[model samples]
Target: MATIQSQHKWRFFRSGGFDQVALDSAADLQHLSELDPKLWTVLNCPTTGLEFDCRTLALLDLDGDGQIRVPEILAAVRWSCERVLDAEIMFKAPGLPLSAIDDQDAEGANLKAAALRVLEITGKTEADPLQVTDLADMTLLFSPHHFNGDGVVMAELTSDTELAQLITEIIQTQGGQLDRSGGLGIHGDSLNAFYQQAAAVVDWHAAADPADPLFCPLGDKTVEAVAAFEAVKAKVDDFFVRCQLAAFDNRAAEALNPAVAVYDVLSNKAISSSDKDVAALPLAAIAAGQSLPLGEGINPAWASAMSQFKLLVVDPLVGSKSKSKAGHLTADQWQQICDQLEPWRSWQAAKPDTTLHQLELERLQAIVAGDGKERLEALIAQDLAASTFADNVDAVERLVRYQRDLVTLLRNFVSLSDFYQRKHKAIFQIGTLYLDQRSCELVLKVSDMARHATMAPFSGCYLVYCTCERQGETPLQIVAALTAGDVDELMVPGRNGVFYDSQGRDWRAMVTKVVAQPVSIGQAFWSPYKRVAAFIETQLQKFAASRDKDIEAKTTTGVTAAATPASTPAATAAVAGFDIAKFAGIFAALGLAVGAIGTALAAMIAGLFSLVWWQIPLVMAAVLLLISGPSMLMAFLTLRRRNLGPLLDANGWAVNTRAKINVPFGAALTGLARLPAGAKRSVADPFAEKKRPWGSLLILLLVAVAAAVFWWFKLN
Candidate 1:
């Protein structure tokens, strides 16, 4: 019997027979909580829009399994409220330094330390006050950097100079030893060998006697003469040796003939020139029964005569042969001897040329100086130092960002307690009910009921039942918003009623049990609208069916009566005979009927076209309202009168309070199933036939064309 007073600025309405209040503002909710702590039930409920930080939610969870239950929520609310005053002081002046948090408690000590670190890494002095801007700046530190890794403040060498230094150091350290061919640097031994070879050629030239034409030829003409004689002598010796070997070994003949051919050419030239005596020695020796010493025992004078040749040719050949079998050369040794010949010959030709000698000396001197080595070492050192400094900077930044995030999280969780304490409804509710012969479970929670609720007669508020048939037996369950009347009717423990759900599924529901409690009944002034809708629906359906049956009967009777005359043989014959006058009269009547219909349609169309475009839309809108106004009005009125009394009474409850499940509150009671976040699932029936939309598209195209043609004509 308690009615809400208008002066209180809070409105109260009867819902499910209980005095219910709608708290619109934060202050209104706070006042309601002060009136009764039980009203704080909404604080423990999981809400959709609050968007609590995941870490804060986890901290409140206590068990750490990511679910915040009622007990956890209540504990969080109490803890936060107790510490709220301390938090408020800090929040009121966000610019306060870490020293502002002066509590002796462990949590306070941790916060103070965290605040100090945040200020330090953000490049703020300890004396500098923290601001909202500082917190925002700290969040930016978590942004992604060039490096690919997790955590705030990654190693970012953004400075071009620093990055270039890093690249140089890497190249000097790992790629420092590479040669021109991209192979590893030459060994110390190879460097020494190169120097020794160059020195040897120079020394040989320096030691040469200028007076001895054989050892050192000074003029171009003299050099040519000496080279020709040496070449002819060498060829003759090689040929004579091959001929001697051919006498003992048949395979030697193959090499002997080629050498003989070269020797004959040289011998003919020698015989006709002044060098015949020198060239004929090896040939005459071979003809005499003596086999020339091809190994170490060769005449010493002959060897000495070839001493100038030794460094240029003989020494390399001898050295290679020494590495092989006695009097025989291995393939590798032969190849080495041949490979040394070209470079040796080149050196010999350039021995007297001072220009090349000076250039070679300068290059050798530069290599031994070691200036490049020192520069490379300095670069490596710089690179190492830069890397260490960068790593240290990143570490400090990460610590600072971590501290900032923690402070922000604490601020959010602490403030949320007041927010929830002022709230008045649960995110969801659960109940047990019976439908037909089956027990049903209900999870009632909705986001917005005013927008989603149905406006169709009893659809606004009714006991909805859903039945699932299994194994030839159909089981029914009730999924409805209960009213006081429904509870009262069911309180007897065996009340039965028929119910229909949104899907039009029928259920014969019966009350199996009822729990006694303080119940609310919904009784509003608009309750009569539901009754009116039900009456209208029933009467309309019955009238339409009766009228359709009557029309069908009349049509059938007329057809039967007309066929009776045709059925008789005499009448059929008369009807079949051609009657010009009668046919003409029938045609005239048909033409007149069609003409009248055409004329009336043309007049209506012309009247519509005569109206201005703006007025035409208004007229059409008015006509539409005339057709659908009654149904829409009925639905709207019924929706406004939606009550929970009949639903609750049907389930047997002694209602004492008005617990109004209004548009908004009713939504939170019944939750509809929705797709989970990021969920994707596709189902396809294998037996389904593929469909072509072309036929429907073609029909739509034709309709559009016809409309366009009509509009064009109308405009003209």
Candidate 2:
């Protein structure tokens, strides 16, 4: 095969201990496409941030598994090269119009049609070349607000009066021309300014008339009344204190003059009554003689004195006479006073009722009434025009994004082509590693490795190593897999054997490092069963060893006792005298155990026999499936997903392809033990014994007899 050569002199670069070529031109990309598919730098890669035409990649991923293989990439490049005017044209221009595309090819025709449709949607002339601006415009024109179910430019105001008022407010609040194009559109910066200005206008109007319309007369009256009641309460308390003192002392009332007496007591008649009571009481008793009592309802003289004083003083001072009369405040009287003062208490307590809404409505009405309406209308018109232009600009911006994405795709593919052309011998540019301990595999391309060399490698895969210890006499081996990264600094050969992954996560690993090949599913499938068998064999050997030791101990004791000649006779007799009952009991117990197991087996067989003939086979099949179905299914699935991606990803390579290692391919990747060429081994073993055919013949005869009996029973 003729090796492909690059038309342009490729610039060389070093990354991750490998030589790399810079893909700077379309010719470099074309030369790469001509090289062997294996020589391509990457097979499968995540398209997340890398620019590549999604449609092209989709075409390249033949299996639709979101990965593009070398063959797929090569095929796509070849197809495009054959059809397009120049594959490089994609990278040269920001975009091309539908007319620029060749209509001869199906792909070009479809793309052209799509571009034309985009132009139409954006309200651009059909002849106009499709650009990033056109795509952006289309997106904006179809946005929620502009293309809502309702007709374009829906009325912001429902009523003519409201519209006129809004216009007037806008004119007065924002006197300058509505420069929507200059950042005054709905989503523009000027809208914020507009709001601030509107708020200022409202504040000015409110300041001019500070009286709140929602303010209630009752609220003010309630406050005033509460203050008045507080003032009166102090005076009443002083009067009460003086009266109480006077009642206790006869000379206490003499201190109060006629002017002070009227203020203290509501009536002059109360004073006369008090004087009569004082005269009736003995002067010595009134002077608080030790035998005289002053308690109410207890002493007649004291009671008569208190009763007259209260009727003439306390009743007229604090007691309520009628609903209209207020001598002093009582609980009911106080409540009545509050109620009269504030009737809107309940309304006030429910929820706050601010007058801002009413104020705003008034401001709007005022703005609409004057000559400001015409100016406001003009401003609205200007704003609408600016909004239309802004929407177009947004569309253009979005279209530019699409262009950038396409440019990125072109750049990546072109670069890949250059790399391939320069490195023809790198057939396995993407390498695969298998880790038996981790049961993980990785397939890494050159680019993925370079990226991984960075401080923060991608998280998809990691390299890890650990020490594996065998439970028995086998020496420990260091095993590694695509499972750990540099972040796992604490990981060591022994200890917890923990390692960190590329994602900076820790994991306990049994492997030291990833290998070039891993154990296949066939080998893995029987590993557990083999381990169980080995364990059982070891246990049985240990049990046999223990039983032999016990027997040896007993023999040694018998020999030791026999060495004493005196006990020899008794020991021999004891050995010779076999206990028939004990023997019979031992046999009986053994028979019972055998019978129990046989009975259970018989019962199970009988149950199977009771089923219909066809059902018996099905039941047996179901039993077999129940035993091995999960194991087989798991093995099959594991085998299918056993790809080289994870292993490569761990090593910091971005595998863009499935790179599946099926059974046959897996076998090739990992070799099994085999005899060397021209090697010979002895067929005979020194311990081998001759076998007789009688036992086998007898077993076959018994099986035949059993089959005959079963057939006879079924016929009967």
Candidate 3:
């Protein structure tokens, strides 16, 4: 309940049954913060599903929370106003004039420069105003080879071949980030990580010098030797264990060796030296205290592995000592070979986890020794320097969008002027729905029909929820408020209509649900009569159907009796004859009932005609009021209380005021069918259905007879 300050002199206009602060001038926008939040038409609105520009809404949603609140709106207004020389430019559309920026402010000066740069890149002159579309492609403003202030350093930005190669390698190995210019590149953080990892790889590789025989027993061939030895290490160990078991018990040799049944199974298949089944056998034959044969006698499955092991291991360890040793490796010699490569195994286990391991050790040392890291850091720093300019350029685009959309949002959000004035549609008024011989302009996009219907009834307006469909587009649900038309044709579900969206795209709309409420006082006045007439018609139809069934049954019974041959005339008379007394009694009862009804009608007519002419009309009016008065009163009250708050609140808007849609405003929202003014018409029709006058003549005859009977009784 904070009052407006006297110095600001705030202007107010009443709409939606409440006072709304009118943002009439630039000063109003500047002093918007001073306006109390309670007076604002809307406290908050969702970012999506609105007819307004989503981009502008996103910019105004400073916290990226998918909603724009009062505070965010004020912040956006203040920021845009401070950057521009004239705050009035915000009310303009299509573009922002570059010269209008307040160059005295540092941020505004940067924006001006960025705006000029944008125009220059788009092949426009300085006199031209920069538009949001002109800055659509940011690559035009920032080249991949130049510093774009994104802190990412692309290889193309460097001139030195070595520095460029270093950047390219880092991107390929460490995975680069996306730059503002759309190229993948690194920043200062990635550059430092790359060097730190490279240093670890260099130090890890330094521990395994080739000249040191302990780690590299075979020098450059040690890596290949390790691979060869590992392949048959387990199989060779199994063979030696089998030999030791044979020495323990000579009878155990037969059981330790491959059974004869295994050889029989291998014999059936086309076995190779690499056959998996054959490889499962021992590397060599088992015997008491036997050395593993390095040549010729090894199993075919393990022959290749044994040859590599002997060439790399046996030749190096045995070292040309007399050809009499016979190319066989003792168990102790195998142990020596495994022990020789232990240091290399430990070094491999300690290797650093880095992508830099793919690079040569010498290249890594060279990069660490030189100033390549420093140069890369300098390039990254250069890119970061232009970050302020890039940020302002982005800000310039936001301001341009704000210029065209901000005030429009203010009008809709703060005061609903756009809706009340009827000059333009409000942000929530999605489209017009043409259905049931009427056009509805107050339609909202419904996300969930059932959920919306639950709260929509509280709005006190007749709503038609339709599922709108178009080819290749998802079916959209929308609720249209029918404020001006009758509900007879609109109350039914599955009724089809055409919906034209804000973009004028036509969708075939089908009514999925209807919230039945009074649309107008005229409709309400006749509702009672319509209901009574409908009830009478339904009862008449049922009565006629039952009478028709009875007549058919009677005719069938008579035909059967006539077709049957009676034994005598007496039997026939007994079967079909009518009694005179019964006929007299039936006629008398019918006469009495008709006379009683006639008497009641005559009495009512006599009573009606006893009054004076004025009294007669007054009596008739009182009767009419007794029937239709309650209906019209209820409708009037409901229509007067038709608030737009609940409908929008259901769609995720915090409407603060009682935004009423009264009778006059409701009538404007929904348009009824009518002929245009000054149009010619033909009352006579050649093809029209012929009307019979007999029904009217009958009604007149009945009224005249009742009148005469009443007069005759009065004269007596």
Candidate 4:
């Protein structure tokens, strides 16, 4: 029988010492021969669908880059995946036993090998995602790390070393160590039940009991806790005082992520279960077949605080915890919940070097019985029996030893995962900080290029206006100069734009909203809205100065005096603060107004040339309003929805914003009337252009009235 010859190729496979060794060109293609000869024949055989061999390697090396990147080798790899790899490297492997080749066992082996293979490919050398247990841990320890927004913890407090230390101490002091991995139960034993027991044990110290004197010594600890808490507060005060900018360094979040992730992973059941499958299985299948819900089960309020949170809802209509929808909290509610959850997440984010993938190894081992090494050895011995020399002890030993090498692999897998989780957090944080700081810095640098924000140029300014928007449904806003352009863009809803540079990042706000036409600072004082009215007042004051001081004073006094009547509750109630009765009342009044307007419009149309268009609601509304008297109920109702901001501000509170409303056109006027003194101009009138079609209403009313009049006229 002729021995099948190996071919030359260029490839980098890791040596035992963890060094890259070039093989294909320098040596021979033994990677294939390492499997069974029959399987190899079937793969490369003419009759089989799988094709290509050494020539395939040549095709990969044709490029000047001189290395076979992932894309270049895909064709051969894809063919290999279909049947070749399984035939040779797997089922026909020289050392594998016939019994182990049975469908069930082979299935398990295939699954495990797939898991291991995934790690070999696609994973980055610098920081492997699969290697890291808690990517945040590695991220925090690495350099160029910066603080991003925050985690579940009070970032402002946690960023302070003193507060962090105090928190660490407080948790340690309060939280008795839980033996998370200590006990294992067989059969139907519930882990959640065990956790509950553990919880009880931990809280036992906090419970008040006459027989239990744990509370006797609580006095001393309270004082100490107070002192520690105070000390932490002091440090926070100093950090705030020392901060030169709006927020802490961006990398600060990166540093915290590791700790946060640790707690999160440890507390998270889904992530841990996903990690369990990693140790026993091969990388490829483990990764491809399953995805981890890491930190997914975090407390909703706390999870909401976490930026990574994704809301999942089951049948929200039905009552099921897991089936709940994402709950959107108000800004205040969001802040309140986030404040509570941040600390818990911060504590969880810090554990382990291995990632969810690596942790799965332990989990798989625990489930299948025995550790990773035991599983690998059993697999190797079982497969070696499939060889033609299945009865030979020597071959069996060699195969067993070969498969045992998996221990080294398993160890490295754990370490690498550990590194990634740690570093990922730090890197993410740093990236965040860099973006925020750089955005502001870039804008400052570009001011000269920006043409000195006059009203015209300012109106076009879409960037630098993205603030915490009242609603995500709306676009980012800006105080634009109407003089810059037509100001049409400012009036439309969602007329917002984001600015991006050559690189897509830190998109600055570029929203535009025209509040007023240009005016002097003096004229604004006599105007209703300050910024616009003040500028007018400023210019008019200069002109009026030569004319008469008394007239100027009178104008200013008239403006000031006009404001007093508006301060009353009646005016406040005139806004959209209307109740059920009021809402209906306003609609009724509006209905009558439109009826009158429609009548007048129809009359004008009739008078125009004997051809009438009675569809006009405006003229009908005017006519109806004139015929029907006032609706005191609607007037009373409109007063209830008076703007919340003005209500709060008038009681010695500064609204402290140039906020606008998202009320519809007609509602915009009502909204504007309700605006607090601190409310920004460009405040929309509730009833701006949002007029619904009156044709339908006109038809309905006209049809009823015309029929009645016609019947009466016919009878006469």
The per-model lDDT (C-alpha) reads 0.42, 0.44, 0.86, 0.30
lDDT of candidate 4 over 1-716, digit per residue (tens)? 23445453424333221222232210222243332232220111111111112222343333634333323332333322332223233312233322232134443445334323323433423123222222213222212212121111211222445433422332332332211112111111222232233334334322433232232222333333323333323322232332312234544433422244555655755543235432222211111112212135322322222222222111211113231233222223323323433333343343322212222333323423323223323333433333222122222222222222211221111111111222221100111111121221112111111232332232212222222133333432222112111221234433433343223344335333222332222222223344345678888998788578878877887677666566677755764254899889999999999999978865554443232447446566666454332332332233222222221122222222211212121121111113467977886788788766697899899788765654554465
What would the per-residue lDDT of candidate 2 be over residues 243-277, giving only the tens digit for each residue?
A: 55666886876563234444455444454434544
Give all TM-scores, in the order shown: 0.27, 0.29, 0.76, 0.15
lDDT of 4 at 645: 26
User: Which 10 consecutive residues of model 2 have the lowest summed lDDT?
Assistant: 285-294
Greater-TM-score candidate between 2 and 3: 3
Please identify model 3 stretches exceeding 4 Å from their true place.
1-4, 196-370, 448-451, 540-597, 676-688
- Candidate 3 at 70: error in angstroms? 2.3
**Candidate 3: tens digits of C-alpha lDDT, residues 582-682:** 99999999999999998898778788878777898899999999999999999999988999999998888899988899888888998989999999998
Order of candidate numbers by lDDT, starting with the best: 3, 2, 1, 4
- How accurate locally is residue 356 in candidate 4, as Cα lDDT from 0 to 100? 24
* Top lDDT hit: 3
Best by TM-score: 3
- Number of clashes in every candidate structure? 45, 35, 0, 138
Residue 554 accuracy (lDDT) in model 3: 94
